[model samples]
Target: MVATTASTGALPPDLFDTTTLVSLAATLVLLGAGYAASRQFLPKDAKNSARVLFVWHAFDALIHLILEASYLYHCFFSWIPASSVTAEDLGSSQFYMPQPSPFLGHADRIYGPQAGAIHGNALAKLWMVYARADHRWAGPDLVVISLELLTVFIAAPMAIWICYDLSMRRSRANVLMLIVATGELYGGFMTFCPEWLVLSENLDCSNFMYKWVYIVFFNTLWVWLPLYAMYVAISEISDAFAVRDALAKVKKSN
Candidate 1:
């Protein structure tokens, strides 16, 4: 991933480049489509809260599986071309090199780099495009990668299952949603806090999209939404317990 370039005291030409625009557009389109589809397909009898939960978690699960999972796969399995420079040799260099073709069962030699650069899969390259926009994510950050691995592999599927249970109106869904919401809230904070605390200098606030949209809004969405889910879960659970208590009292009186 390309980091901050030498400060020319002027804005970088590629600050909000074509890649960023494309990515932003694709994200918005996907989100809009996913929400609309969920609204259309979910049972009309379902509660509004249930519908919202289904849409959000369904979207989250798909993103984790399709987008974040791809990043994780490339992080572990992306092969550097034999003729390309190793990661160690390319330390802190501003030069951008195209990553080799993604490993799709077998490597495609035709698209693989012949020399002088490390390569990642198609998804990884897409991720790199976003990462390169921010100084904090220039290279592979192990902390973020580790968290993503868990989220993509475990939490995402669990969220999908919870959504299904919620659609069925299972009382246990509240507990599961609480659990998933906690994980999301924790993951969201851990994803960026350490970097902000320790590597604040590397942060690039040069671009409005990178700073506000990507760093602040995109990341905090998980935080706020998860918190809301957790609130709903708690309220539902408390109501359930209160009803149970009332039933018990009536039985005792009888």
Candidate 2:
């Protein structure tokens, strides 16, 4: 795959010679949509805190469900016989497939997130661009698969639930946010730390777009927001406890 990936061609030349701009624009548009939903649907007197929570989680649900789920679809559905794979199989898309890809070496079929490069599948190509940034994403890396499974299935619905809870003023939103946000922080750690321990072998840091924007900036979106979610949860939990304590003190005094 490496022998031919270079010969295949360069990344798409538009949007900073990469799909970075496209992905970023889409993210901002989704986030903006989320904010608009909060403004239009959430009650007028709803706290800014709830509005913010609603917006972020709504964005989270859309990203995880629509975008990230395609990754799983490629992994589960996309394939070709490796024995018949050729240079023409990998076209103009710049995603790499490791020479003797660990997943393909022992199989008759090759399955990867790079399916877009292989077959012109547009949805699969979305991830293939990022796969150029991180090679682990190019193939069926087990750790990545496991993490994505949790992300698409569990975290996504949890995000939607958080949005509903925020809109309804449910106290359970605090616990849900705390739990899922902690899991998200853990998810980011597990996704990268194992690679770090290996000196980031599968990570391609050869360019600013791949290194800074894709790896650092995009991935950290999950981290930074989850930290904020945890803070919000902890603060509300503490406030609830304080109110309970004050009420108990009044009852005892009476």
Candidate 3:
């Protein structure tokens, strides 16, 4: 039942390959749910762009609330002993441990973000599947956790607000989209830039699914979507400014 690997240790990918397929189906289901919601929640008069934004933001918010939040949960509550001797003393605590454990060097204490597979924590395994792509997901990596904190608590609510604004057809939706999009781009950059600068030591890109689908394509969405949002926001704002200038000229002429 080992889920994550080539991170702290090399685990058999074939054994857990089915987990990847299952999680992929679930992710698609989550994404489809967002689009379905747009039909119900968005107004008929709403533009196609609004509909797309609504679906994307809704999916983003849910990811923060559901999947990412679950990661935080395991980080906070899941535990495994750092010391082999401590693990022995704990007794019955080691039903399914991570091989080449991230916590092994620390010794004498419990560490987490690696939930026990014995408990049948499907969500943890889902993350572990992704952790195989990026080691940072397998343990308590500070940068990832900090970025996720903002992503979950702050970005999640902002994304929800954007969805609400899009549904309501409010001008503030543009502003919110601009803000959230900027934050997302910044988060995406910070998440990977350092790793890139350090030659991507924490990343495993050997697998096609891990490299193309999970790391590249998934991360690219944040970049592309946010850039589009920023464009929309700036365009609308510029139009507003032009209108204001035209009105000022009319007043002076009168």
Candidate 4:
């Protein structure tokens, strides 16, 4: 069945409703609590901000692997029915059809009009909720999907490892963070710039939640935070090199 529409015939409640706001608020609170808890496990001399950074990376990794991966899985795999008989029963004669199961297909029917329903699964339905909120994501943009797949599968795991290494004061952490941050910065720009250049008609900057929260906050966070992480990585690398250079000079002089 199609997703239920709002009574006013404007949009579904899940599109840009209070649930989105609550989810965002709860996420922020959970991140804050995680940071606070991380601080207790940190070295006594650790900087206050380091705890927050650790938690951020940890959360980033979790989101990439769990949330983004789920989206990606549903994007590709959910199209294939569990059983051939089910596809045949659904009126498809093909053996390997790219269609959602009966239940998700019903959701697709209900919610598909609000946003593009590429797959007929709960995850795809949830994806459409965000899509309806941000017009930029209203369709199944293959470019965006490919980028997300790379980010979720490759970059996210790297971020998780970097977080662990940084917490343990590993020497390679800065270099790894530099790499990940560069990828993030590039990914953020690529995800938006092409669409903007094409004069995207799908962009739905109608209100505060869609314009500011979903589009601005969600996208820019990757840009700004990754930029900052790159800066930190560079500074740390520079400092280490400077220290090594000084030590080498002193040894030569002696």
Over 1-254, each residue of candidate 1 has an lDDT whose tens digit, in order, gives 11232444665566667655666776776677667766666677988788778778887887788877766665455544434445564443232232334324334321211121244344544564556444323333556677888899889988878877876778787898898899998897787677667654445555565557666677777988788889889999999899999999999999
Superposed model 2: Cα runs more than 4 Å off: 1-20, 86-106
Q: Using alpha carbons, what is the TM-score of model 3?
A: 0.84
Residues 1-254, model 3: lDDT tens digits: 01222434444445347777888888888899899989998998888778888899998988889989888877666765554434453332222223333343544434434553324688877877777667677665767778998899999999999888888778898898888999999999998988887788767676556677778888889999889888878888899899999999999999
| Clashing pairs in model 4, backbone N/Cα/C closer than 3 A | 1-106, 2-109, 2-110, 3-110, 3-111
On lDDT, the leading prediction is 2
lDDT of each: 0.64, 0.76, 0.74, 0.59
What TM-score against the true fold does each predicted structure earn?
Answer: 0.77, 0.85, 0.84, 0.73
Q: Residue 28 in model 1: shift from native, Å? A: 2.1
Please tell me which predicted candidate would have the highest TM-score against the true structure: 2
Q: After superposing candidate 3, which stretches have Cα over 4 Å from the reference?
A: 1-16, 84-107, 116-118
**Which pairs clash in model 1?**
99-119, 100-119, 102-121
Relative to the unseen true structure, what is the Cα RMSD of model 3? 5.8
Candidate 2 residue lDDT tens string, 91-178: 4344456334545344666777665446876656667778766777776777878898998999999998998888788889999999
lDDT of 4 by residue, 53-127 (tens): 567677677667755676666554444324323435333111211233343444342122112233334444445
Estimate candidate 2's alpha-carbon lDDT, on a 0 to 1 scale.
0.76
